[model samples]
Target chain A: MHSFKAVFKRELKGYFATPIAYVFLVIFLFFAGYLTFRDGFYEIRQADMRAFFSNLPLLFVFMVPSTAMRLWAEERKSGSIEILLTLPVTIPQAVIGKFIAAWCFLGIALVLTFPVPLVVCYLGDPDEGLIISGYIGSFLLAGGFLAVGTFFSALSKNQVISFILSVVACGILVYAGMPTTLDYLSNILPAPAVSVIENMSIQMHFHSLLKGVIEFRDIAYFFILIIGWIAACSIILDERKAS
Target chain B: MISVKELRRTFGPIVAVDDISFDVAKGEVLGFLGPNGAGKTTAMRMLACFLAPDSGTATVCGHDIIAEPVAVRESIGYLAENAPAYGEMTVAGFLNFICDARRIAGKAKKEALDRIVPMCAVGSVYHQTIDTLSKGYRRRVGLAQALIHDPDVLILDEPTDGLDPNQKHEVRLLINKMAKDKCIIVSTHILEEVEEVCTRTIIIASGKILVDSTPALLKEKYHCSLDEVFRKVTRTKKSA
Candidate 1:
């Protein structure tokens, strides 16, 4: 437990010690606001945060990976990984600590977009339950993407390659359940296969959570996704650390 | 405090550490001397619990490397090759992180920092980010973290690799001061370091031990300087 806290604290502080944190925050917030407003927030004329939440799956596909790319890749590149793994901490503790810290960092970014919700509340009465659910879904979606990023980060020593791999992996997860993609696959494949692919899509679970009626299956899907990817990451690091 | 039994490690077809075994009791400073890729770092890494031996096992501070790796790691302080540290962290922040990992908290944490900061001569760069410091300061900071836990075993691979003459002298002096109690294994190619601080020397080549003896006795046996003795043994082994 102490080792986990130490790793978590160091990794969280490390993100801010470099300019990467600031750059990531500024870009993330800017694009978030841009995408929301550009999607015709006024034209929709709704008090809900649909415009904001709708853009997040795509936004997180790129942004969450950026936050996670440096987790292990930078350590490997700089040779600090040798020092870290040699410490008393186990690989699983280190991996989870880093993942949680990155998840919290993304949560902070999500919270920074508070002004949009505040403005929506001031302009009209919005259902608090829907807004809360939207934020929760967004957080889980970011965590899911971050888990994928963590695995890719461990797979490559170069941050650029890690980021690109994460983006590609997350892109598939987001696009797999889209209506267009599903329709295309339905023509070529059987219904059961198409439905399996749809169920595997992260966006499907995320959309269910956004409706403000959280089902056990949706929550379970995110948990399984996050835990499964993190487990794979730990296994990879354990096997490849000596190399 | 360290014992190896036929410890062997191979990377693909190349045998990085080929069936080597040695032991160091308390109060003995063992110097590992070898050329590049001679498995000095690889062997030290296995002892540090950072790498696993392929076909054999070792014990450090009575904890087996493979069976109880975390316990082995807890009892030893390791300075890896190049003395790697988090470049973005300030000297103080980095040390505190190590303290946290070592589970030194509250007053004990303060005491560990107080003692190690001055001993490693890293007080001057306490607030400086590691990347901004010179190679010498970074090396000292690395050494400081390794000593903070004050473990019974110390595995340092190339502890003085990038220091100036004065810094190297100070480091050797520090090792000599600590040599009376700790079981220390220092890997280096510098022969004078063995003479200055090491109680015994082991020359490794092609992942095998070529010679293991006291520095004074090795010199007397070869009837030459320590430098000449090293070259002769390593060269003959390479030819064979």
Candidate 2:
């Protein structure tokens, strides 16, 4: 528990110490403001948060990778990873704490964009359920992407390699649910396998919540994948015990 | 406070630390003397519970390195050659994080902070980011982190590697002061440091322990100073 808090604090401070926090805030807020005010107004015919939420997963597909790719990669590069692993903490404790700290920072960046939907609510009678569901969906999608990034971060020592690997890996995860890609894949692959792959897509479940239905099954998908990926990360790191 | 039996480690085809055994009682200052890549770091890593040995076992304060790593880590403080620290953190913040991680809680945490901050001479740069601080200060912060937990054993891998003369003197004095109640095993290439800070010195060559003796004995046997003893022990001279 003490090591968890220490890791959590150190990681949170790391994000703030660099330009990482500002870059994330600016990128996330710009998309939300532009999508909700300028883009959504033209497409949805009303001041709704549909566009803001729709754009979130796509943004997080890139943003979350950028945020999480550095978590372990930087530590490994700087050689501090040895110091961290040697501390009186279990591998799971360190992994979960660092994961939550990064995810929570993403949460803050997500929250900063809330004013976009708040403006929509002020100007019209938007469905609070739908907006809340959209936030939940985006958060889960972000978590899934972060999970993939965490795995790739541990796979490589170089941050660039980790970032590239995570981006590509997460890109495939997000792409699996895209209609055009699935349509193309369906034509070539068997239907059952494609269906199974589509079901595993991070975007589809994320989309379910955008429509205001936060089902247990969809939530479970995110949890399983996130837990599995983080477990894989710990296993890989544990196998490479340096002491 | 520290004991190892037939410890060995091999990295693929390369033997890093081969078949080594030694023990240090409480309040013993053992200087692990070796050249670069002489298995000093590898042995220290095993003792620090950061790496598992390929064979044999080590116990610190009755806790096995493999079975009770958390207990072993809790009982020991370690400093690698580079003095590892998060460059983004402030000196005080980093120490606080380490202190917190080491479970120095409540008033005891504050007491540790108060003691370590100045004893490390890091009070003036408490708020300075670790990257911005000088190398000597960074090393001190590393020392401070190691001392923060107040463990019974300290494993310092090249503690004074990057310090000015004054800083080195101060660190040597600090180590001597702390050695009264704790077992401090320091690994270094500088033999004179062992003379100043350590009571017993062990030299390893090519992953094997070649010598373990007090400084005076080592000097008398070599018929020269500590530096010559280090050269004779570590020098890979071929018979000509």
Candidate topping DockQ: 1
Predicted model with the maximum TM-score: 1
Instruction: Considering the two chains of model 2, state its CAPRI-style docking category.
Output: medium
The regions of model 2 sitting more than 4 angstroms off are A36-38, A240-243, B236-240
Model 1 clash pairs are: none
Per-residue alpha-carbon lDDT of candidate 1 for residues B114-206, written as tens digits (9 for 90 to 100): 999999999988999999999898899989989998989999999999899999999999999999989999999899999999999999999
What residue pairs are clashing in model 2? A242-B51, A243-B50, A243-B51
Provide a comma-separated list of chain B TM-scores, one per candidate: 0.99, 0.96
Q: Where is the poorest 10-residue window by lDDT in model 2 chain A?
A: A35-44
The C-alpha stretches of model 1 lying farther than 4 A from their native spots are none
